[model samples]
Target: MWSGDELDLDAYLARIGYDIGRDGELAPDVRTLTALHRAHVAAIPFENLDVALGRQVPLDLKSLQGKLVDRRRGGYCYEQNSLLAAALERIGFQVAGRGARNRSRGATLPPVTHAVLAVTIDGEQWLADAGFGWQGVLEPVPLRAGARVEQSGWTFGIGVEDEGIHVLRSLRPEGWTDLYAFSPQTLYPGDFTVMNHYSSSHPQSRFLGQVVAQRPGADVRRALVRETLSSVRADGSAEERIVDTADLAVTLEAEFGIELDSEERARLERLHAAGV
Candidate 1:
């Protein structure tokens, strides 16, 4: 478990652009939790650069803090949610790690590759996840059947399927899209270690050959998938373009705030150019 003392709480708070004193309330309430969630997504992006670079993704608090907070880099679900869970625990919120499966196409028995959080605050349980990329939930919603939440012009709902697994859905123009599904089973650190290893190292892992980075702004969300750059507005409209090979480094830095060294940049350029 990650303790507050294990990391620099002040620095972590600053990295998320959260103001503790200014809020004048230090208790772990809905307001604080929502603010923290919003700040985290806005500050630390959802990225898979290390996987693309063939670097091991570390799950330890020290490494996560050093990379995400200290270096101002972004990470995927495991890192982002782990960091948020630790911070919430430090702030006196009752948090438990949960795992989920991608259910984009209503696939019933998908592998539990995604990580989420089950938080209990003031005798109510809520779902909080900071690493769902572009279509992530913006705030913690009550863990109740048929509960609906509207955030930043997007609508999300939580419900349980017939199989007794909780499913999260997003409101789309056509209909509700099933984002992911998971049971109420609690996940331990070791489980995440196994899942993370497969996600970051396995040859068949989708993240291995792709470069994905996403960050949500106040009105627009930016996502970079391989060589394509997409910007989606709050109204669900989107604009996309294929990035030139020569401009990849500059675009990554300027648009996504990800700065890689010359060698790293060259490697990514080659990988994307080859389209392997």
Candidate 2:
């Protein structure tokens, strides 16, 4: 429910820089979905800079809104996906918060590390994800299988990652490669705390190790901390950059549109230097 129309909708949109209308119904057309996806890509960046800096990445709604929609900060999947869900819901889209796991990482990894959205309109479920870093899709992929969901020329397919996990696969010249997996499980904010801790603290986690990503443009996505910052084109093959954090705050603002305070910057720099 909205806060008696006193909520700052424009500020919220400005925080994310998502150009979509804040007070109107989310347009159900494919064009709207594409545009929204691009806005998210250009606006919300995928960065673990906060965790590396020892800042607590809170999952509560107010905290999330303040950091992501007010302070113009970037966050990991749960925060990014969760905030987007709130905005879409306010715009009159029937959105469902779904859980996902990284099948490529390992089967035993904790659940709910990834969050996705299932938007229903005209009784059809459309996949809307703003949080699956690097290989993130820029449009709603159809939920049906064998039905190729083509965007910007590349084709995607939906299938089973496991009994309970549904996977998104990219149709390449060689074969279909797994993209990511999600379940119908709707999670509360509390479910993410542990995962966030692991992602931020666990040395074994890829994010904790090193990875750099930026949403340079609506359709342009890149990251290098993984040793490869790849930018996927409408066509599948991508251009890559080596990841490094020389001037992190500048990168945050330039690449992700995040504005960090001096205290926040000092904390982040300290953490990065400590590598904890």
lDDT of 2 by residue, 139-194 (tens): 78777655577666657788854555678777667677776778767665455566
- Give residue 113's error in model 2 in angstroms: 2.0
Q: Candidate 1 versus the native: TM-score?
A: 0.94
- 84: Cα error in model 1, Å: 0.6
Tens-digit lDDT track of model 1 for 1-276: 755558788898899888877754556888889989988988888899889989999899999999999999999999999899889888888888888998874556657899999988878889999998887887888888999988888888998977678889988777888899888888876777888998999886778998888886767888888888999876778899998789888888888788888798889989878877
lDDT of 1: 0.85
Which stretches of candidate 1 lie above 4 Å from their native place?
105-109
Q: 261 in model 2: Cα distance from truth in Å?
A: 3.7
- Per-candidate total of colliding backbone pairs: 0, 3
Q: What shift in Å separates residue 129 of candidate 1 from its native position after superposition?
A: 0.5
Task: Please state every model's RMSD to the true fold in angstroms.
Answer: 1.6, 3.9
Candidate 2 regions with alpha-carbon error over 4 angstroms: 1-7, 16-34, 104-112, 161-164, 209-211, 216-219, 226-249, 263-276
The TM-score values for the models, in the order shown, are 0.94, 0.78
